[model samples]
Target: MMTVFDRRSLLRTASISGRAALAAPGLLRAQALDEIRIDWATYNPVSMLLRDKGWLEQEFQGDGTRITWLQSAGSNKALEFLNASAIDFGWTAGSAALVARVNGNPVKAIHSFSRPEWTALVTRADTDIGTVADLKGKSVAVTRGTDPHVFLIRALADAGLTERDLTPVLL
Candidate 1:
């Protein structure tokens, strides 16, 4: 008899192997897990999709692990939850993750799920603020320690302006 492998079979085998490897440590402990807290943010469509699909529940069904889903308003809240040990896993922007790491949060970036444009500067339709320079001396609404804040800062800097040049309404 001869053994043959196709691309789909190879991928399926790899996926199963990866899952077993991840579960090895927990299985070795021979302890039952009560719950696994995970966060889902509005900005992360994948997280939302997973929660809706009940995939996590299915994965841990045999282990009797409870999948607790926490809602995060933004990266700051997600990072805060992670720092407070409120969540076992979370979703956040790369910039926010870097900021949290820099601020001494014991965090790591394991995956990049999406790369859509996550931040932008907007003004009223009637407002004449067509450029970043026009934002100078204007009050810009932003959430501190979030991707939008980082984007605003970088955009301002690129326009040869700083936060001091404008009024930042931290939310």
Candidate 2:
């Protein structure tokens, strides 16, 4: 059981200027959030930066928020944890988020944390393949409904190929 003071402290960091504080009237008395916890899913540098810097913890230490780092294997796994209430917050890709939404997972993207394109396709140098069209009738490996999947779909479309034209292996 959390005290009213604890809840107010937990919610204090949620505001930038006193607006969020002013907006919610006696929110702590309502929620008793003395033991509020947040779960984080981090697989990249920005997450690492936030964690390493202890920004969130620093903000919540006074409020008694116990920050727990949840290691997730992938977006799908992260979504599973979220659905199970094992995590309160997560870092996921846009495509993965959409897939989770389509699959009935309840989540909202509060921010876009990254915008760098960070994936590519490669083949053996001796294969002699010249273009995306050459991949038809072949097998493509990608995490389904993820960025790689979307990129593959676009590339294949550019080459006049559909998923039906080849085997898509989800990884």
Please estimate how well model 2 matches the true structure, expressed as its whole-model Cα lDDT. Answer: 0.65
Top candidate, metric lDDT: 1
lDDT of 2 by residue, 78-130 (tens): 77787888875666778999989988887766545446556677888998667
Model 1, range 1-171, lDDT digits (tens) per residue?
Answer: 323434454334433543454465444445777787889987776667667777677777787888899999988899889899998778888778888899888876544544555567889999989999999999999987777887898999999999999998988
Backbone Cα, N, C clashes tallied per candidate = 0, 0
Candidate 1 residues lying further than 4 Å off, grouped into runs, are 1-29, 114-116
Model 1 alpha-carbon miss at residue 109, Å? 3.0
Error of 2 at 133 (Å): 2.0
Clashes of 1: 0
RMSD of 2: 8.6
